[model samples]
Target: MNLAQRINAFQKLGIFFKQFSTAKIEKHSNSEINTLFFDAFKMQIERAQEFNGWFTKENVLKAFESWSEALSVENLIEWTSKYSFSKNTSPKTIAIIMAGNIPLVGFHDFLSVLITGNKALIKQSSNDKHFLPLIAKFLEHTNPYFKNKITFTDTVLTDFDAVIATGSNNTARYFEHYFGKYPSIIRQNRNSVAILTGKETEEELALLGEDIFQYFGLGCRSVSKLFVPKNYNFDMLFKAIYKFNNIINYKKYENNYDYNKAVYIMSLFNILENGFVMLKEDKSYASPIATVFYEFYDDFDNLLNKLNTEKSDIQCVVSNENVVDFVKFGQTQHPKLWNYADNVDTISFLLKL
Candidate 1:
């Protein structure tokens, strides 16, 4: 298929995703073969949580909504406008190793490879095995050209020109060792942080609660740490996030809260807690579930320098325009199509291959 055809196919796929993007599924009148796929996909979404505890209906819908909003005609055009696709060039097969941390987490890489006219050989994480394949089926049905272009394997990946892999810091070392000879983009563990200036309105901090509680704070884009000014009041932060206190109603989340709270109490570490979330003074970027690590900064200049120096460990900086290139509060998970992971341009890298 040509570039226009590829874009159209994904645009259709996006439309398919939109049907499931809400608590109540809404079918578009013009959707392709909706009778064949729509109800089936809904069943898959309903059963997703049984397959993986983290894939709650609410979180799955949030992911679908985000992708639906992201895959508009304007977004597809803007995202792909910069690349030149040569019709005469042979398309390569790009292998993708996806992380199952969140629903459809590796889809951008999958979409990038296919949009660039390269075939995709995806090795999906066992924890997140069901949803993407159903979408792939919808794409193939939308356009027959996609049939030969997509493949999913559970075994070791093979016969691909380049690779894109996302995993933890430990798994990254394994990826680098195994895929080192080939051209690759291997992503390591990176966490997002919020920088509080003690000036954010209650509304903004409430929005920040979405960034933290969404997906139960399992996503890399989820803000797991906080960088606050000295003597920042915990009362305000706790009060702003009280709306999400219901998150503790989920058994898995409540278990984590109890466990982490118990560990902290046993260790006699000072922490601030409401019923659902806890904040502890920690320098680490990655925090445990049901907890957000925090550290106080005395000097804004030093904080900026420290964040800059440790950029590799950070995926995004959430702030109120205090830091350069920082993501606004509550906007990290809503990254635009062009917002590449690890700040590595996936499309540019795919174009080179």
Candidate 2:
């Protein structure tokens, strides 16, 4: 299909996703997509946790809500306008190795390949295998050209022109060993962090709670660490984020809380807890579930330099500070279409192939 046709089809697919954006999913005949896929998708969302407990209905819905907003015509047009697509360019099959940490996590790479008029050969993470195939079916219904544009397999990939893979550092080495010779964009583990000036309003800190707790902090975009000024009273942050205490009700998260709390207690690590999430003074950015690491910063400039030095290990930074390309408080999980993961522009990389 041509670029305009592909964009039109995806915009319709976004409209399909909008119906599931909220807990109160509504069905309507605004278009044929609703009647065709609405109930099936609802069933899929309900059963998602059976496959992966982390895919709670609310979290899955949050992902849908984010993608719905991201796929709006304005957003899509603005994202694509910066790229030039040549209709006559020969299509290549781009293999994508998806990460399953959160619902539909690798979809951005899939979208990037397809939007540029290339075919996608996907080897989905077993943890997140259910959603995309169904979505691909919806896209096929949205436009016929997508009928053979997407393929999912469980076998070793040996027939793609290039690769875009996301995985842990261990799996990354494997991907490089196997796909190294080909043009590729291979991603490794990276965590997001929040820089707190200790002067944030309660409303802003409350929003920051979303950054920390969304997707149970499973996605790379989730904030796992905090950079705070020295002598900072975490009470302000705790009180602001208290509303999310309800998250403890989820069994998976609660088990993590209990286990991590025990580990901290036994290790004699000083930690602050307010019944649900725990805060430990840690120098690392990737914190375990139910715990967020906080490091005290003495000099702001020195801290910025430290972050600059470790930029490769960090994803997006959530801060109001004038850090270049920093994400605002709650918006980390809701990245725009152009907010490429690991700051690697997937579109630009795909265009080169």
Candidate 3:
């Protein structure tokens, strides 16, 4: 298919996604494919948590809503316009090793490979093995050209010109050792953090709660750490995020809270807790579930320098302050099509292959 046809198919897919949202499920169109796929998607949303405890129905719907907004015609055109798609270049097979920490987490890479006129060989994480195949069927039905362009594998990934792999630090090493010779983007663990200036309004902080609680804070974009000014009061932050207190009621989260809290007490750590989420003074960027690490910064300039120097370790810096490339509060989860993970342009990388 040509560029317009390709983009139109995804736009239609987005419309299909818009019908499934946490707020409500309503058919906005009479497209027959909706009859085939709508109830299927709803079943996936309902059964997702059974497949992976982290994939709650609410979280799955949120992913659907987010992608619906992201795949609009304007967004697809805007994101793809910057790239040069040479029709003469034969499509390469781009192998993608997906991370399943969040729903449809590997989708961007899958989308990128296909949009750049390449084939995708996907090895999905077992944590999230379900949804994508059905999506592939929907797309194939949307555009027959998509047929034979997508493949999912359970065994070794082979016969690909280049690879895009996302995993933890250890798995990344394995990827480099195996796929090092070929052109590749092998990503390791990276966490998001927020810088607090003590002047944030209650509204902003409450929205920040969304950033923390979404997907049970499993996404790499989830804010796991906080950088606050020295002697900053914690009460305001706690009060602002009280609306998300219900998150603790989830059994998995509550178990984590109890366990982590016990470990903290046994270790004689000075941690602060308000029933659900715990705040511990820690230098680490990656915090465990039910906890957010915090550090005190005496000088703003020094913090900026530290963050800039260690940019590779951070996925995003969320703040109201003007930090270059920083995301706004609560927006970490709502990244646009152009907000490339690890700031690496997947389209550019694919085009080079």
Q: Which residue runs of candidate 1 sit more than 4 Å off their true CA positions?
A: 30-32
lDDT by residue for model 3 (1-353), tens? 77788899899989899999999988876678987888888888889999998899899989999999999999999999998897428989999999999999999998998888789999999999899999999999988899989999999988999999999999999999999999999999999999999999999999899988899889999999999998899999999999999999999989999999999999999999999999999999999999999999999999999999998999999999986798999899999999999999999998877
Write candidate 1's Cα lDDT for 294-315 as tens digits. Answer: 9999998898899989999999
- Taking all chains together, each candidate's TM-score versus the true structure is 0.97, 0.98, 0.98
Model 3 local distance difference test score: 0.93
Between which residue pairs do clashes occur in model 2?
Answer: none
Task: Give candidate 1's whole-model lDDT.
Answer: 0.90
Alpha carbon RMSD to native, model 2: 1.1
RMSD, one per candidate, in order: 1.3, 1.1, 0.9
Q: What are the lDDT figures for the candidates, one per model?
A: 0.90, 0.90, 0.93
Compared with the true structure, what per-residue lDDT tens digits does model 2 show for residues 1-353?
68888888888878778888665787756467677788889999999999998999888999898898888888889999998886439888999999999999998998999999999999999999998999999998888789888999999887789999999999999999999899999999999999999879999999999999999999899999999997898889999999999999999899999999999999999999999999999998889999999999899899889999999999988998877898898999988999998888888888887
